[model samples]
Target chain A: MHAPADPAPLPGDRRHPGWIAWALLAPMVFWLAAFVVVPAAILLVYSFCERDEVGGVVFRFTLENYQRVFDPVYLRIFARSIGYAALTTAICVVVGYPVAYTIARASEVWRHRLLLLVMVPFWTSFLIRTYAWITILKQEGLLNGFLQAMHAGGGPFNLLYTPAAVVIGLVYAYLPFMILPIYGSAEKLDNSLIEAAYDLGAGPVRAFSAVIVPLTMPGIAAGTLLVFVPAIGMFAITDLMGGAKVPMIGNVIQNQFLQARNWPFGAALGVVFMLMFVVTYGLLQRRGARLAG
Target chain B: MIEIRGVTKRFGSFTAVDNLSLSVRAGEFLTLLGPSGCGKTTLLRLLAGFEMPDEGVILLDGQDVSHLPPYRRSVNQVFQSYALFPHLSVRDNVGFGLRMQNVPAPEAAARVAEALEMVSLREQADRLPHQLSGGQRQRVALARAIVCRPKVLLLDEPLSALDAKLRHNMQLELKHLQRRLGLTFVFVTHDQEEALTMSDRIAIIHRGRIEQLGAAGEIYHRPRTPFAADFIGQANLLQVAVVGRNGTTARVRVGGGLELTVASAELPAGARTALVSIRPEKICISKQRLDTENLFEATIEEEIFQGATDQLRLVTTQGTRLHALVANESAMQEAFHEGDRVYCGLHLDDLVIVQAE
Candidate 1:
């Protein structure tokens, strides 16, 4: 079928109306400047200034705050945060891929219903949901009691306030983020391609790896960015589930502002964290571009 | 070689393929020709093992593979959409089957190159499917399926996606490819001319049943059923009553007392009347009186100027309407105008009776 040609420009409209475009974009530009850009600019300035003893930002410039951010202890936390985020991302992919694929390929009525189920969790407050995890993972909580009742394990097992619990919380929170993007890609996949794969003598697994997975890589990459970037900087889950025993970069950054009363140091850590997200996003985008090319 | 016996496929309540039996001779290009939803595609899917027949067995080279999955069967399909892997390079897509079969890497590479060369797409080997044109992607799909060297290749309207000019070229190319490879081809299409051009045998399907199956010429000239007669080519169906029968030819009366001679072979024994098919091109319209057994005095009612031929709509003196396709020669084009009196002649050999419905 022939694509409709673009409509010809109206008479006397050879030049773009620059003022209308600017007027339409004004609100978004104002919002970004007021909230994101101005706050980021303030943080950048604060990162080079000192904090007074009275828990107020001092205008005196100093390199000490940024130097503290590079210390071995904070660096270790940064590495650990990356490790946790990577693990969370891997688990999200493994768990979310099949669910997303199933939902995507489901019959139309069921596909919408299943997607609604994935999003149903979002109607509740996120903090309330994180606390709900506490009720399930505590020593005498629903999980340990169920395990005990089933005779699958011997004791309450110190399940809460652990790294495993923290990971479980992180995965639960971000799994839908992984599922939605992957679903977007998988839903657009042509059924004939899968049939062609089978006709070409590739079994189900072979077809999945050779055709389906690569075709859906863009979604997986998008989901990874959605899950991984936020997971690395997430402080609440680690605090509520890890019981603040181990500090991720997010927890340290949070403690600097709230408990340590070190605004300059917190701003420095925030700057570094934002830079890492930029780098991670850039690498993922480049990988996606390479795959497309 | 392929043999299908009493296969039936149903999608819920809708029967896509009725109990159908067909056989393809070794290396023959057999086309399942039908309009959409006539079960031609379903039958092709049944052969490819994409859809299992609920009621029958399929034999591929004498082995029963009715319930086997597509990957287990030694068959490949060139999809109508040319379902080449968008993420894979042309070389990779072509080599995918070999890789799954666990052929040696070197042999797989060599075969992929050979298949690409067969389609004259060696230059596009490293490019993704999206990088190529529609025709190039179709070639890649062909290469991919052929590299496996399956006993049978199923093509689901592969050329339907191309423009008319390119489709004609690919029809010849596909015919040559099937010949060179010596593989049995089970093709499906709604296009009548495509089926006639490429198939060694054509199975005219209607509502999941084979109405008629024969070589292209036999199907065109002697369609057993009215559906087949009308589907393949333009045929003027005349309702006639048999008045008398000689040993070989029968005299049949058309509307308002026009008698025509038809071969007795077309009439069932003791049948009083029959529906007969006459190709439009078979009717001769001339200014001079014609010396034929079945001749009628007619008036040219309308003339349609087709590029190669001018179609003359004629009304006999007895008020029977018929269409005659005459060559578009300069003299003929000007000779047959609306309201001109002419003699319309039909040959006995051109009139064949076909089954109703």
Candidate 2:
């Protein structure tokens, strides 16, 4: 056995033994090891196991669950879910950017009031808010009733239980996520830089595109990640507003556990879903770094 | 040439710039010198079209540009922070204004290269603003503003951020650049030394009005107002009562009943109560009473050695405090100590009669 040379300690670490530091970190370490690491290890192990006939774990190793996760039916559902999430991110950006910019540029009094308004939706339960949207958007809801009352020449249109309704719900739920981050970036932007641009002969449109957009890009990237990742895995809005008519990846993964009682397949799907997130996030980080450089 | 007439800019109840008027001659380096919140920066912003004057007309080459936006005006400003785009390279930052004018790529590139060469930053053109040192960034800002060849350039204390030594060097370089380009330069700064070194004419502003506007020597030696006298350089403002007037000069009695002669053309007509402004350097000190037009005996209260000169605080026999600066030359090797009796002499040409206000 060989003893390694002791490196110099940090500035304030000389008085305390190394074990004291570990003892101080024990609670956080235990919580992560118990909740996160242990669950991930279990999921990885179950992903390769087989299920018994009575919907219990057989404890036998197999690759069949992983193979079933790549079937055409489930792959299409994953693609549809990604497409919807991308569209929701785009819509949120388009609608939230101007609102965030306005709030950031407003006077201090108005800025705080407007920020409070943006966060008011978070005070209530998200499920209750989605249910409220249902009443306003359904076929016989307030919109259709108002249209019928005006004696319009068309029948009540099917507004809910569609892709448009799903997108609307996702955008509404995730808009504040977009606004808050972008506002943070916009608020810290130096006004003198804009004035410098105009003084250098750039018009208003040119200044906004050249100076403003590139400066606020970090916030846009952060907001996109905040809205896109969870939206792909969302099941509540699809079930309520989308009527669950079209199968999404979330709907299928949720059904595998509850209705089919296929725990191994569900574990496999979850592992694959987590892997997709890792890859997507890795790509976005690379792109963000490149843009910054 | 730029001319501002009756410019009054008010922000709500506070008037930042009062009814002020100034004419910047062609190719002249005029500095707006004042302390903070004296509306010197507001006047610069007005010329840059960042702020519209409440009542005034700004004429560039005899054409009204008061209502024109900053982009539309043929003027550029070098902000105090440099305001260089952090994401862009030095070359791109310098070439931004030309690109805005729809200049062709090759021409804009050549102009950018020339401007960079002028500032001696050709090698670091590919680096961003953050990568450059403070002085290098300031030069880039200068290059950026001058590359467009605007009729006028407004600089709002652009050299205040640098260290003292670098600021002195940049001041010389900026003066050389301004003279070579022959563009009207309107600079704003509270530093009197910088104003005296770089400006052809200095406009001392105070409380939203121009107290005095003239060449550096005139403003320093003969300030018409007390504010200008105190703001420009160190001055001993002695309260005096006018005894009589004598053809462009006035005889005034100091607090100690001593009479002195000073130039009085700037003083208000028939003014009895007046103030006499005298430069500290003008008063000479000696061990014996020297033969001079105005002589006074005082006790040296304190002596501050400042390498090249010694600032002596003297209290006259009548209890009037006065400051006299003596050169630390070899001929005057005998140093004056505190509480020593000394004779201070003031020349006739060194004093100016100013308004009591």
Candidate 3:
């Protein structure tokens, strides 16, 4: 992991009061404690507790909730969730890299305009945007209408409630995350190094693979984390796009809390999902570190 | 091995490399020496095929490679920033060219090892670029470029980033390597001392044109233009009007009253006014009367104690101000101070008339 981006210390700054540093750090510490640490602690406690018949939690400790998380039914959902997230991440990379690189290499005025276009979708609510996709992919939607108007073979395909629709929604929602980070990396890449590669007898393909790709790997890694971790836990897109037919791990956990009213089991599933994210993140960080080394 | 014929490159409205033609002899260390933005780097880029010329043909070993890309041409460049691949190990960086060329794996490895050995960076071959210091990184850049074994190697101020001691050592090492490999090197630098020390022939560039190109000693002692004379070393330029023309030397009037004779070989034809270049170190200041033909009495206006010499600023009686650098040995004996009158002698051979800029 990179070091925190603290500003360089000015000379003779040690004479300031000791409380100043604490004052500067107070807000961030309070935010993490209140939102991140407190929620995780509550989840951990609830994962070990038993739930009552009416969805109320019991004070007695038990291992039943944890045992339920390891069952084959949830494990299969977990594997499918990982599969969909990985597929989404791979598709995002293949589609986003060229767009990011083009924007990074564009002229200064055009670069900012293009980046603004990339972020314009975030101005609207995410659920509204997902609804917009549902409109486009549903039967008699704009896409099918266009296809029918063109007299294309195969009438009104059932594309709205499929696994492909879910993957498409996931990729569309998280593609900008991939683009922004890779653009940051590509913009900072030195031009002369590319020239040096060409000067050393590398063609366009070889120079890109040997020089440009490696130089921008950090941004690619960061983008992967940003898209992959959250994608695995996303429930709304899978529910709306898959019509709740294909229950991912996220859909299962959501069902446990609301439809099934098993609060302790949902807490156990949430804790396990959080652990998977931590493990995946750790593995990615290790790979990034080795690549850099 | 390379010939640049009337190459002209323009960026938008600004002409970077003007209609300039130059030729590089095979197996010679030719340096493009000038201050920054004088189009020296542009010329090097043109020869390396990084930037195509707008109006000329670049022939590499009798082949017209002007329109070809850098990879198709047999030329490599060591960039000013070193440009070492930060993500790759030194070995991989050096082997990048061979890999691109589809060289066999075992042969590529041996050549990479040989290149690393040449740079004496064998131990650091497996380390990434950031793991090495500036000098080692510089050597890695050198090895990476040379491993391709190109017909010409373009070095764009490759030593500018190193510390003084390391830069000096690298200069010697580079010259030795060039000789050992018998490869043509077209190096560029703004440092005159570095140019004088490392170049087999220095092309003194000014305003996208070569002001003078010759051997180091020749360019230093016999500069053809006023810019060449002043840029190579410290020279006191005197504006003089041509008074009379002799067989080979011409009598010129300095300022208003002082008169001197200088060789007119380098002077532009039919020029009524010319600039004479007098190297300060060649100016002799003596307390005793000297028998030189071009001798004048001058008062010392200022004296600066340099480490090896005393820099004396003198104003002639006829209102010609001149700077003289006298050896510390004689300067100590004479102990010339400000306001002291002294005799300044200018040898006829030392006074050269050069073309005005």
User: Which candidate wins on lDDT?
Assistant: 1
TM-score of chain A of each: 0.92, 0.88, 0.92
The TM-scores, one per candidate, come to 0.95, 0.94, 0.94
lDDT, candidate 3, at A183: 99
Model 3, position A233: C-alpha lDDT score: 90
Please, what is the whole-model Cα lDDT of each candidate in the order they appear? 0.91, 0.89, 0.90
Q: Report how far off residue A42 is in candidate 1 (Å).
A: 1.4
Which stretch of 10 consecutive residues in model 3 chain A shows the poorest summed lDDT?
A: A1-10
Q: What digit string (tens of lDDT, one per residue) describes model 3 on residues B31-69? A: 999999899999998888888989989999999999899
What DockQ, on C-alphas, does every prediction get? 0.46, 0.33, 0.44
Quote the lDDT for B109 in model 2.
99
Clashing pairs in 2: none
Query: Where does the lowest 10-residue lDDT sum fall in candidate 2 chain A?
Result: A1-10
**Could you give candidate 1's per-residue lDDT for residues A1-293 as a string of tens digits?**
11122233344556775998899999999999999999999999999999888779999989999899889999999999999999999999999999999999999999999999999999999999999999998988998889999998578789888899889999999999999999999999999999988888889998898889999999999999999999999999999999999789999989989999999999999999999999999999999998887
Which digits, one per residue and each the tens of the lDDT, describe model 2 over residues B94-190?
9999998889999999999999989988888888787777888888899999999999999999999988988888899899988988889999999
Extract clashing residue pairs from model 1: none
Measured on C-alpha atoms, candidate 3 has an lDDT of: 0.90
**Residue B165 of model 2, lDDT score:** 81
The best-first sequence of candidates by DockQ reads 1, 3, 2
